[model samples]
Target chain A: MKPSEYDFVAARRRLEAKEKSAGEKLTSLEDAAARVTNGDVVAVGGILFSRTPMALVHAILRERRTGLTLVRNLMCQEGEFMMAVGAVERVVTAWFGIGLPWGVSKIMREHVEGGKVVYEEWSHLALGLRFRAAAMGVPFLPALTMLGSDLVAIGPMKTVIDPYTGTTLAAIPALYPDVAILHVHRADRFGNCQIDGYPHMDADIARAASTVLVTAEALIPDEEVRRHPDRTVIPGFLVDAVVPAPWGAFPHECYGLYEADFEHFDEYAAAIDARGTAGVTEFLDRHVYGPASWLESLELWGAERLARQARRAHELVPATDIMGGLSTPPKPPALGAPRQSRGAPRPPDAFTGYA
Target chain B: MTTIASPTEWLAVVASRQLRDHTTVFAGVGVPLLAAALAQATHAPNLTIVVEGGIVGPRIKPGRLPISTNEMRTAYRATMLTGITDTFLLAQRGALDVGFIGGAQIDPYGNVNTTVIGDYARPKVRLPGTGGANDIASLCRQVIIVTAHERRRFVPRVAFVTSPGWLDGAGGRERAGLRFGGVSGVVTTLGVFGFDPTTRRMRVDALHPGVTMDDVRANTGFEVLSADGIDTTAPPAADELELLRALDPERRFLG
Candidate 1:
């Protein structure tokens, strides 16, 4: 569909009607998953492996939600699993893969090739810009992405000539998903979410979607959230439900909480490689369907394994302290003769003491 | 010095040498990350490495190469932690000096195709579509492509242009309205390839140690061009190999 064809005004009206009162929005995983109807445009939060809302995805699968259009900037196992289980009808993403060590996802490749799923492509920046446009309540945003690429030729991207410069620019349409399911570091009962480390378009996705369902690792008090208001990436007004789901992004890394379960990924890769969709179904039966809750799902890996991931995560230096006391150095002058910089003096070397 | 470097190692070394000291590079996953890390460890300690996941100036740890750019390991010692949009905006605003990426296939004009192998509609391999590759290639000042050298990978024309290199050739990018930044070089397994300034077709700039022009010709699907004088790529220095091995002791990416 074209950007002009999407009803941004109606989406805004729907969001405006959602309860923005300072009341508890906390709910169970099943209850949150129920908000996502079949055939809805559900934007999955996080990029690649980090901070994926896998627990929410599993809950949706458990609820047997199908024919959903999954949208994200990047897709990994979450997209792969959903496709394997026949939940996704379409995926609007810039990239889809299992990443390195493990290469392209076998399930994604098969489904796209078989024409069972429609894989709409865009550049990573363009996808993010679409969310950005929606969040800003605009129909489209202009960008330099996908100018000469085939993505422009095939995808929904449109080009316009800039009257000011006469340069052709890509007009990225707003992507207003029906719902956005996100995994956060913490959130309060009222859905004041705080995402530590990289937010990775979650904030934009939350605002862009009409309904926002968050699965947080921890549920903090509203007092705690108010203590550091700046840390709140997604405000309570934008969120419809908050589900406390620890290890919600399991098998995937959650910043400051745990590392990705690489072994589990390897096992999943092997399973899909060996048996394709049937193998993924076996995995879902064991992990998604078999477990009673998100916590129980993590238990399938046993306490020792869970503890190891957490321990490894904690062992790494916190991002704030990684380069403590070391300031960024001034960029070295270019090899060629220096370009005129409006009469500004050359900065001193900040690396003098450190390096 | 007697150690024989693997193709990946050779590619990484050659790719790393393309990076200048103190330049900011937007590095993709796998070999691009490895090469960036290697460059930082050796000649470019001050190289500001930016991963697509919004990690800037990270001190990449040894033996713990990140599979995904968003992995916390890539966030280690990061100077700034932002989001995907903010990170790419840096490239868009011209803050990035280099964009290092890898692909499944590349055309004569250096246009990369990570999207598909055959027809986009059906019937062949559907590779992972463009991630931040197109944005990086289009926005960054210079882009370097690193991938396995094979005839299937180096095609005369890609099935789809996932990343715009030189588009059709010489003035293609300019005509396409991409004012700056086209592919600077492509570091492959057998040799280093560069674009002809006039035609913009990929040309053999240098063949790696022990690799012949015939090997490059046989491996590349396109009718390859040779520079006025093709140089032999220097073997990986002992220190370069040592540092690369230390970074990937498990040979996760090295292999």
Candidate 2:
């Protein structure tokens, strides 16, 4: 093939226009849901329901989309809520429910028992590693987790041996989701998102999916996005759409946002225990389907509850609280208390030596 | 009127008593949190509590229990924020001394069954599958098996082996190539059980206060092994109950 004539001046103008069109990335939740198709494997971010994109998910549910494969880590309220709304067909990940003495949620258990959903469980490491593999464009990730367990036999996981050593190893095939939805503390119109606290696996999921939709608590100015430039977790080019949804993570913590609504979760769990699947629907109808939008749903919680639960990052200056509420230790633990197990955490390979 | 102790309260204290100094405990939530918190405050103040999500040594807040190990509270004051790979790598290297596990059923050999109740392909009841519990049970140097003591849960043979405790009656775990760990204790609402040294089978080490040997045998599906002399467990001290309640003020997980 012969090279064609290049137009440098016009190309430069187009690049400048693209950079200035940052506001174009901002869209409504309805438009974000429009990007989702039935049967799409959706990667939902947030660990244990903390910092989930509630508005985006509610909008997606209103569209009446079903048969979607959900990739998740914790089976918290999001999994159960989706199941009640008929938004999921299968779940691939580890853990559902809080564990005994409460046990897994009745809704999740009933769905599995009725064969409404297939549960493919994996170790947290294996699940996360697979997402990283997909993000890196690899076929599989070799890991040491689930090596001598039954999850490998029943799920997509398999055993591969090192040809040189003849030692068996576990592998999780890459999971490239069609869409990834994440909720973050803040982001600019350009989709440069900042996750205030623990980013369980959002970075990996966003990179692995073909399209990334972010629902942020606030859409800040370009300066705020670049303030701590090096701390930028999600790069703008990777994002497909961004929505500003306040209280985006309801019934769960959002770091400097608000405390996890333990009151509601308890009520939901008890309702399920008392009425089984029927209880799940009642809670959903009242809280989920009934609301016209995420902000409107705030009326259900009332202003007093929200104000009481509000947790600002500055309040917890030295340490980041999970629920954003303040907590003072009963007593400062003895600094050099007789050492236990000499296994105090060592710095990771990446963080070390750089110092 | 003085209130009677609930099973959860009794079990948490009984489980916490098992902790000794200089031991790393692995568990996620519920009784494990209550027990670990109680131990850290009262007896073993220096205990290093490890969560599966790679959060190690967090000063767990008393009034709030994180929903899962994945929650940021688990990493609140954690000295090391290693992910699952590093946490398990440390476990495989024989760092953890005690691992706490919950199960649906347990056989005499201590093989845990959390997969299904009746059949393999089609089960009458399907449980949420293992989430690194298999590794916790397989790799830790010792494990504290916490579960109900119903005839249904204490079975003759588990339907499926989700986490290996002890394979047949003898050297099954060793035969399977597990590098470290075995069932050191089984903490139940009724009593505590330890494995036989020579036979490697579970036997009653001690019974909780007010529990009878016949009661333990009746609740268990399999034969309840007992030695010539079995000790009785002491009741929870007044302070222990006070601390346990502090760890879970709202009874969020305990209830």
Candidate 3:
């Protein structure tokens, strides 16, 4: 039931109070890494390349933690974020999508191929599985999908028989992560976070975790929260801690804050198409690996670097305006190669109509 | 002989091989598209791939095609342009042989749910809208489900009904007199499973190569039976991969 008499003004004040309080601690993301221990199950929220909380993950890597398992719906670009920093021992996910600058690095792929880390693959639905189990207050759910399909064996699955029917069924256990991290657009005191844009599986991850860490673009007033309650994806009851982090979804799109590095993504996809993972590795090291600061990622691809990368990668670069002053590198030929003037006289036989 | 391969590759190979020669197979987005394209190239050269938007065997671009309508790019040469309803009608009239789909939840009885992740009234999560999955799953001669393996999706009960597989449970389907052959098999990123003949309940019929029984059980949501000496599913050959690529230039609708 909708609350009667919305008090947006009071909600706004409450949010401000929460943000001011969190600002006092100002703990470096690196310090937060200490909370994750070896062999702990972790779930990081976000989808494709949108709203992913890389800032928190970056802090974990800075601490160089290891022997921890990551469970989630999507974990790709930051895979190297786990591998390079030695913060992860194994990864359980539905699929891995890595691009050039922030995607799966060469080292991570090699690790997956070399068995340095266990690659426990699953379908995108698995993310929903965890959340559904959490919401249902059940241990696990049964299913009949992907049974005869390749996911069983190719995924290296083991089979068991249902005692009830004596018929065999594939049993995939429900995932329960000890920690879940998410990045959102706004949050109020008490941890009710709102996502202004496409929210992939962020809410689901938040529900499945014992502790939820949130990084928001801003801390709105409690009154504003009441005014726009529909925007809140996670209720205050589910969140543990909230930090206001700008550009939190760095190298990825954050609804109102920063646009996705599409030019970089194109470059990364080309790298995967051309040199495979090695190219992807070199690209990540230059942009996502070194500093935990988001500014550093932008700096790594400063104007000149982005142009050069785009040229070599043969991609259509984004309009400079969309870049929001990353220090534009000398502009290269505009992407789609500016169309020739329509009024120009056609060259002698240039347009011979095909027979 | 060929044996089980990667989940994605296995799906491409098996689905392609199963489609008859020159048959027009109507596939939903994702694995079904991969299966149809691979089959067209390797097994059924004359097969016509009809995307929801009417593109027929048009070259598929890369990345995920979130909706069935995205196949329009490949439907360039399609014999017909149709909407979701039109496509389902084709399946109902016996104009299509195979239908590939994905689901959010499935029960032992073969019932499928792509709507909500939890129980009917209250749900933990609500997914994208269901298009023609119900009609295709219920009307098609053979329906192939392609999704990843998990306990949540392979649950014993679905919170909602987006598509009917076995209706209630064992014999629930026959009792309801549900028309159309039910789900033929499930191809996951892990292994392949089929329904038991007697119980009409889903079961593990084979495993992909290098995968073990324990591995399958570890990820599956429900208890499953194994064949006396479960055989290994065949892997895709180089030619099959090339064909798959040809049909899907951008690698759209795949893992």
Candidate 4:
């Protein structure tokens, strides 16, 4: 379908219809997942391996939601698992891979190849801009990306001669998801969300979606949230429900909370390698379905293992003591300082010699 | 003195030499990050490393390199932490000097394909489609592709153009309405490649030490051209190897 055919007006109406109440918005994971019905355009917040809404995704899977269109900047284990279990019929994403040592996701590849799923590819910037357009209530935004790439031919983006510059620009349509599930560091009972470290694309995703469901690591008091108004990425008015799921983005790292469970990824990779779709089913049975709740799922991995990951997270980003403010301002080497002077003599002309 | 550098170490070292000091580089994950880290640790101390995950000017920690760009490790000592939209907007406004990325397939025209191995619809191998690659390639001042050189990878024509190089030929980018940025070179395991000034076809500009013309010809699917008096890529120096090894002590990326 052409991007022009998208129901922008209906999307706007849906957003307008949502209650803007400032009352307690806290809810259960299953209840929050229930906000997402079948065939909904669901946008998941966070980038690959970080801050992904895995708890909500698990909840959605257990709810047996199907025919959903999954959206994200980068597709990781959550998207792969969703596709593996037939929860997703389509995926609109920039990239889909396990990344690094794991490489591409075999399940995603098989699904796409077998014609069981439709994958709509877009450049990362374009996807982000699309969400931004939706958040801003604009129909489309012009961009310089995907001008000469095959994505131009395949994706929804179309080029138009710029009226001002006489240059061609790819017109990216505004993407309004039916529901956006986000994982945040903290959120108030009233649903004001704050994210530590990098806010991948959650802020825009929250605003762009008609219904926003947030799975936060902790539910802080409204007074605490008010103290750091500058850190609130998702305002309460935009949020419909908030599920306080600790270690919500487990197996995937949440900045300042814990490191990614590489051992679990290794186990997952091995499982998929050993048995394809059946392996994914077995994983879900053992981790997702077998356990009644997200917290119960966490118990599968012993406390020592979870603690080690949290310790590693602290080590990686020493300034995790947010309430106390930055303990030590990062001191990077002086720009252009000759740090290598003590080692090897600088090559005469490393840049120009090759050409 | 001979430094027994692994293939990836050699690629990282050669790729690092491509960057100038104090330039803002949009670095992709894996080897690109390793090379950028090495560059910052060595010659380009002032180099600003931008990850698509919105991390800018991060002092990449040794041995704890982020497997994914958005991981907390990538944000350690980062000069700026912005959203993905704002970060890519920086590139769109021509703030980035270099874009360092890797791909599964590259054509003679330097066009890269990380999307699919066979057909787009029903593919033999479906890759992790273009993330920020096409954006970086389209907006950055220049792009450098770092990938393993092999016959299957160096295709006569990419099945799908996830990132545009010089599309078709000489004025291809211009004809296609791309006003800024084009591939400058491709740093590979076997050699360093450059594009022809007029034709824009891939050419062997510098062969890495111990790699032969026959190796280039045999591995590349397209007709490989050679630059006049093509210089041999300098071997990884002792200090460069030390820095690269230090960054990847686990050999997670260096291998």
Candidate 5:
């Protein structure tokens, strides 16, 4: 049902009250991990390896639960870790890979080939919109993609005749996960979160899930949270738990935090190369279980490696500044030498065609 | 080999030529990225490229071949950094002109298979399924495929079509209610191919320099028809090759 004016008013009052309430929403990573029972559908927030909630994901792995259904943009990198641990019995995603020589995921490929993992693959667009349908409280979303492609047959999608026009279009059913874990740069005591770079499918999945949990790089004050309310991708009202997890996305980048730890990826890749799925146990021991805490895991990298991973402000550019200052039009391309901006009025883009 | 260059280098050159100046191209990583960057640096400087991961009007980062479309480097100096939904919605509305696709296999009808090799449920090979390649092929006015020329890559029918290219041989996409344009052409290591207007089957428009019809026919698994006036693909000019090398000095894509 559509929310009424009273619902909005009530929600506002509760938020205002929470602002003054004793602020301590920080939960232990282990506690957060325990919430994820077996047979739960978990939607992870990230694209490739960027902004994945690694700390919590590791915690879940340590818990040793099975029968998980993972939903994500691409089942690769960190998602590959989940499959390696035998946590994910099924994956409902678009693409799966580590790129380069290894096109398909290693152990995940084995599990699927061995009839242990059920791979429910769809086009990336279909999966994104399916989450959107859940967010909007709709049964399905009509999409222009997958109608012509064979993904409609292999993946979980159906074609419906567009009621407005007599044309047939592909529709993906809603995918509301039991729990959605997002990694953010900062959050407050109230659980309001801020993502540094691209939200990707973070905000959508957070809303689409039955429960919203977040692992943040830092826990900021209420003023810092209110400083740019517009930047809040996950609102306090929707967020159920927040864990203060610095370097939460360790191997993967957290945008402004650092770059992807290719050293670790390379090491993992080398292990796979040496012994296909046989090397998984040693890999898990070294990476997932070896370290007691997420921070202690840094010992594997040592101090010098950490220094190189340090982030500079300028290098950590925002994908969207909730502060909303940047509206500058794209500058013309810089050719041969650095392009001298002669203030030439460029032509309209191809979207409108040449003017 | 085109004028005795590697297959990938030839494919990159031909793919870049397909892009028109003052148009938007929705492209992914590797050769597609190189093709767009090459076109920008040389003939089509005004070409706007939308990296499928949310970058619109992207200028290639000086020295990197982005592995994923959403790679942080892909967002560097981009015109607009929007989310996934907004970027693709533009294509759905028929805004983008060209969408570049790289596929595991290309069938006679220009249909692509990136899903699996053997079968759907139980497969010999599990190729990475469509990662917005379906949307690119379905919505763009024209889709350009860049891949190597191998008998295995060219099949009579794709094991599973991940993206449509005239679905069946002719009128299948139209019958399936595709709103916008279907596959226009394919640029491979050996030659350039386009769908025949009547049959909608892949037909050779041009061959790489020094490559013969026999060479092209031998590489393809299915029947390949030649157009009435086919041209030998022009060899990569020094300037174009230089730009491609500069963009990817590491030879990440070229190698």
Candidate 6:
């Protein structure tokens, strides 16, 4: 093959063309998640609160796909949402944010207690290594971290003791997910995706999965992606299906498009606080159910509807949205002072002026 | 008896204790990130917090938050640029003092299972497997296991060995002549634990204020012996809390 034809860029382009099958599109998030089978190791991408494919979570809940093993960089509220709905079998993640706002609540705790779920924690770097392994198709990379410490005791799930070195190197096997679900800011019709901000390892995850389902806020033409391929995070070849599911990210923002609807999230969290899952389910039904797009759902739950929901739920404005309590690290009062009394935190209203 | 406190306080207190002056602490993301910052702010003022991306002595503004490793901006004071593998080399060479980590499953033997919940060949769940953890766990002079302590987490045996703290026993570690540093203690929200010098298995060393040994025993899945008389961990004073908040101004670490 000619150098021009066999180059990485050309190879990528050819692969993308082959991956894009005509008439391959997801009807909805439910249909998308239903395609995944039980006992499949899946990878989903998102950071702490941004860029989560919330539509996919709704779809999984609607279809009730259970016994899934999820491998991801971070598992927070969205991961907990699956666990809460009894959809996830086991989850391996670096760090799981605890507390109510992030969805690490009674249900997640129940699953952990019931032995239905296995939680794996690691340093973020370790988490990144597994993604790199999956991306590179390596069996397992050599690692020296947590060798003699308690961390070594936890996740290496695979171990090959080196006879020569007499040192244990935890062999963290590569993860090849059945499907890698990614929600991004933009994509071409051929499923070439781009991350406007911090991509958070989604591209590597897409490479590691058997099939890739990409949901983007908007779909630009293939030519546009071709024009600036470097901006494209996922080459089209890795993608199996592309759905222009606007507001697919929902609670999570799609960078530059819209700020996270912290108010709506707050409403959802309030419902969770007041009536637990029932309230959250109702919130999901109102905002995330049906064929209507997220934009439509947001319109339906505009200021008036949310206000009514907030009043009816009898919960204060969700805590996650109202950021006025400014509890930052106190500045040194001069060069050195022991510290002032950290008594009862000042009321949120005290910083209302700042808000 | 003292009650273990919130996650933020837990991170701040651990960081305050472990970090020392002029030491180079390799920082991973999450709690380790938090602890490194706290150590730099409190005890180890000159401490160089080296991240895997190769930044050092991060000019951490006063905060209870961890700076992002992916941010090229955070790599300012870094002496060199390297991948996750190189960071472990630094640890292996005794270039590190204290390291912070968390795990999914921890056994009495301090054998962690971050890989799977079942057998190695056929796992109930395959997590994003190990990275520098194996190296950091083995090489760091002392490693601190930071995670919320629950019954499922503290198990009798880990499903897979992600990292080995004490290994089968302390004697086993000694006999094998492992160059990697052995586990010193486990810091959890509820209490702190250390391996018996002889058995190499974990024993309760201290409990956080507002927590009891009974609570620790109830939460732990294994049979853990308590220290002759365990003491309570100090609660984060105002300064500590302030420092923590500064690190994560948005309280992203709280949830």
What is the C-alpha lDDT profile of model 6 across B1-255, one tens digit per residue? 124346656755765586678877766666777777777778778887776544456554333233334332343334453434345557767888776776778888776765545543344455445444555666777777777888989988776777776777756555434555777778887877888887777888878777887898799888898779888777777677666666666656644
User: Per-residue lDDT tens digits of candidate 1, residues A1-355?
Assistant: 5343257898778877777767789899899999999888999998888889988999899988899899988898888778988899989998888676777878888899999999899889999988998999988888877898888877767788898998888888898999999998778889888888777999999989988999876676676677678888898978889987766787788876578888888888887778878888898899999988776777687666666666566555442221111211111111111121233343333421212
The true-versus-predicted C-alpha distance at residue A266 of model 1, in Å, is 1.1
Q: State in Å the error of residue A19, model 5.
A: 16
lDDT (tens digit, per residue) of candidate 6 on A1-355: 0122113343344444554554335345546677788876777876545567776766666666788877665565677677766677777665454322344344444456557777656555556666666677665555654434444443344556777876566555566566788887667666777765345678778876777877776565556566667777787756777766655664554433333445655666677678866775566567556436544654554544433332221121122211112221111112211122234243333221112
Deviation in angstroms for A214 in model 4?
0.7
Best model number under TM-score: 4
Best by lDDT: 4
Root-mean-square deviation of Cα positions for candidate 2 versus the true structure, in angstroms: 10.1
**Candidate 5 chain A vs. true chain A: TM-score?**
0.81
Which parts of model 4 have CA positions greater than 4 angstroms off?
A1-6, A323-355
| A318-342 per-residue lDDT for model 3 (tens digits) | 2231112111221112221212123
Q: What TM-score does each of the candidates earn?
A: 0.92, 0.81, 0.48, 0.93, 0.88, 0.59
Tell me the docking grade of candidate 2. acceptable
* Residue A64 displacement (Å), model 3: 1.0
Error of 4 at B10 (Å): 1.8
Better of 1 and 4 by lDDT: 4
Model 5 chain A weakest 10-residue run by lDDT: A329-338
| Model 3 CA deviation exceeding 4 Å by range | A1-28, A99-109, A148-172, A255-259, A269-285, A299-355, B1-255
**Which pairs of residues collide in model 5?**
none
Per-prediction TM-score, chain A only? Answer: 0.88, 0.81, 0.66, 0.89, 0.81, 0.71
Clashing pairs in 2: none
Better of 1 and 4 by TM-score: 4
For residues B1-255, write the lDDT of model 2, one tens digit per residue.
124567877788899999987788987666886788789888898899988766788776666566667555565667765545557668777888898877678888787877666653456777776676777887789888887689989988887777778767676665455546888889899989998977778899999888998998889888867987899988888888877777788987556
Q: Native contacts recovered, in order, as a fraction for each?
A: 0.84, 0.26, 0.00, 0.89, 0.56, 0.17
Q: What is the per-residue lDDT of model 4 for residues A104-167, given as tens digits with 9 covering 90 to 100?
A: 8889988999999998999999999889988888888988888989998776678889999899
